[model samples]
Target: MKNNLLLGITGSIAASKTEKLYNSLKDQYNIKFVSTSEGLKYLDDNFKINNNIISSWDNETGSPHIELSRWADKFVIYPATANFISKLNNGISDDILSATALMYKDSIYIAPAMHEEMYINEVTQENILELSKKHIFCGPKYGKLDIGDEGLGRLLEPDELINIIEKTKEKIIVTSGPTFENIDLVRGITNSSSGKQGRAIAYELLSKGYDVIYIHSDLINPVPHARNITYSSSDDLYQSILKNIKDVKKIYMTSAVSDFIPEKFNKKMSRESGELFLKLSPNIDIIKTIKSQYKDIKVIGFSAQLDDNLNFEKINTKNCDYLVINNLKDNYFGSDNNKIFIIDRDKLIYESSVENKNIIAQHIVKNTTS
Candidate 1:
């Protein structure tokens, strides 16, 4: 089914950019535009304006809010005012757009635009925290603002907004980042992973025409604009992998899946200079399990080593169909460029000395497809 996007525009000078966003998504999805009272003032008269283009919640007959809510696959509010956000948090419905948002049944995303000070206000922060709990607030990302000051509190780029809409599909599961096995609530075991490589790979795969389902471990920055399932421990990671493996055609085991996990965990634990004994146990081998059980599915494993100590031939012969061997001595985890040896069927079919992870991913996908 074609996606239906309900664009809610509120009072912000950036509301003028709605035309650009509308045009970008017009060919891709069924889009309905809604403008708030304050928003209507900012739009030029040359552009089409009508009640159809705007939404109202209190209309008794058809109940426009509920109708639109049922009509839309996703709801996106651009230039979401601080007031609108606060009302949303408190379930206040003074305006049609905000009312529709409060009543909408589908996934909701908002992009805030305001003054830097307002953006940083404690109340704004609290409302944003509440919005984040239930909705995706993309950015007041750093850029030239509507006001001359120019610090944060600017609307996100149009393409970014479109990407966010495109990425909300329920299919495609991508697992990224490093899983840390917690010894206690305060202390844990993690690896030298920035989650950049996995995130890049996941996004690259998505761009190459695959649905992405991301199981995030240590989501350092803006989590990749994709469906995400957060996991911390190797056990949780393994469970997520197994749950997704049946539906996923390819398993990119790019996460730094911990080899060992603390055998026990304490909820109320501290780090107050106490010698605590930790018993480590092997984590479930996700790739091998997927390779063995789901023989038809492709399993790709990451081999990260400090040096060239691992046997590539033997590793290749193992259950995983392919292994991307990366040497961490060169700081492969966080670096944008990496040297990877592609092991397939006990042979080095392709090798990259030093190249960006994106190019490497393209190469890997090409090889996998062929």
Candidate 2:
């Protein structure tokens, strides 16, 4: 079925590209162009808007904005100005895009484009938070501004927008981090892990253009830009993963799952003083479950052992397609330096210590693709 989309244009240098994008998208789907006052300034007087177009003019006979919002399966705004984004966040209804966006009941997305400073401002961040809270999708991968300033504030390209709209139907899922098995509210059985390896791998997958669903347990640094489901205990993590596994293509069990959990949880620990007796039980084996049931999905697991000699074949038998064996002698858990021996089915790839996760992530992606 041909999709109906409302493309909201806001003021930015990149707003000029919207007409070309509209033309391109028109070939595959229905296009309705709505522009902010600042955006219309750059456009022609009689801007060749066809019957498919929806102008924000309240004086127009039909309620074009409302009708267009209803008609659209998805609404997206490209070259979203900082001022326009702020208005949308605050429900100001000062412009057509913001007003129609407030009315739109369907999936909505925005592509923000502005100067580096404007994009990084607290107000802009708050606007982004507002949009996120509404469950509105955004971003094609974080990039710098069009003005060549470095940072995350770039409007997504036409191809990227189209790709996300299309591929969202069948997206790849990735999970990352360590799983703790709780004893009580205060105590838990956890692994010697910081979730660095898994986070790095997830980012690697994302960079290679894969949609990621990261179940984070122990995050140590700048969090990966993926759909995150946080859990503190192994049981919680286990259930969450099991629930989402049906849609997953590949299950990367990079989380250092706790093997033991307290069988007897003490709810009234403070009330009872003295020796406490706690029984322990094994947590769910995530990799094994995926391997047994979800045979169609590729399973990648990680093992951070204390072994000094890099014997990858022995480590590969741990039942993961790719097993990242990082020697504890180098402090692989929480430390920045990582020396890993990647064990694949037929080959072993060795990596030296590196500081940047991006570099390490690229290596992982290369191996996965190869």
Candidate 3:
């Protein structure tokens, strides 16, 4: 049976974000909703009582708060209001949500949402500090608020909150974007990778609780939850990965590293000069290098083969646990949707139809993670 998640919705304008949150997590957990009276007002009639919603303290047999607390594996209060925060801090159990929160012994994840003044108020700050020592507090992020004023006290996005609630200590290293191999200060060779797929995978991993160390070229999009390290050249990215791989358990090699680099350095190249001659040398394989040293760590490699004829044998030589293959003919570079084939040493494991990168990311993580 799936674990039960008791989602507590409080009175805040950001309460509306819970619908998205529910939709995202419903498949992974058995979710039950419990909303405050004010929270109930914001939700439509679709939030039916007894079936999924638990609004009141009234129960036929015994205390609903106690029973619900016992049933829940984890409790999360999204858009936890200033009023509720104060009530929780003061140990006031006047309502069903507060009463249930008081009895819940496991970690209670809270995402605060309120006006800027109310969030920064001394009382709320103190209450937050008190709660932080025992429970997890996601965010009252800085952004536009419900009252047309923009500042701190905006509820965190649903994905951010989910990442916090589901977070684990395990480390994952994700490398993205194209690595440049400079022939001169002005000229270089690089691949066409835009790093969209890698960024999406990093976000998906973060949402599922992995602590991600993201290494990428400066051009790639950055995920909010990752510890991002920027690199320009293939050598720079290789060194960065080695520096941060001490405790990492998994490495996603999504960066399109240059296969060859200039054998000799040139200060500058003139276009007016006669045809330039240069010697090129093959670059070190980053994934193979890491896997050779850290055999226990799982390595997932990405191959962008221009030809439809994929050499699975060459991929197997890298010693990666999984290889994600994409053909250049499919126009994967910089595109939001992708068609991918995931294979192991023996055979292909999963083949995805052209779909959004986020969906592809979800499948990759689901297949890779135990």
What is the lDDT for 55 in model 3?
A: 75
Segments of candidate 2 deviating more than 4 angstroms: 1-3, 12-20, 38-63, 71-73, 81-90, 112-136, 146-153, 168-171, 183-185, 189-212, 218-228, 259-285, 304-311, 324-343, 349-355, 358-370
Which window of 10 residues has the lowest lDDT sum in candidate 1?
Answer: 218-227
Report how far residue 260 has shifted in candidate 1, in Å. Answer: 4.7
Sort order, TM-score high to low: 2, 3, 1
Task: Assess candidate 2 and give its TM-score to the true structure.
Answer: 0.71
- Higher lDDT: candidate 2 or 3? 3
**Pairs clashing within candidate 3:** none
TM-score of each candidate structure, all chains considered together: 0.59, 0.71, 0.63
RMSD of each: 7.0, 5.2, 10.1
Query: Which of 1 and 3 is the better model by TM-score?
Result: 3
Residues 1-370, candidate 2, lDDT per residue (tens digit)?
A: 7888788887787777777677678877887777787787655455544433444576467676677778888788876788877887777876667788888875576766777578657777666755765644445233455657544455667766666566653344555566666567666666667776666666555544466777777543323245667776777777878877776877667677777878746563664577877787765676776667767776766667787555555444545567666677766677755766667756666565654444555566576554
**lDDT measured at residue 69 in model 2 versus the true structure, 0 to 100:** 74
Give candidate 3's whole-model lDDT.
0.82
What's the C-alpha lDDT at position 148 in model 1? Answer: 72
How many clashes (backbone atoms < 3 Å, residues ≥3 apart in a chain or on different chains) does model 2 have? 1
lDDT of 3 by residue, 1-370 (tens): 8999999999887887888888888998998888898998777566444246777866435788898899999899997999998899889998899999999998798888899799878788778867766777666655688858875577878887877776565899999999988888787888789998887788676555577788989876554336778999999999999899888999999999888988645578777787978898888888888889999999999888876545578677898899988887885589878888888877888888987786788788877888
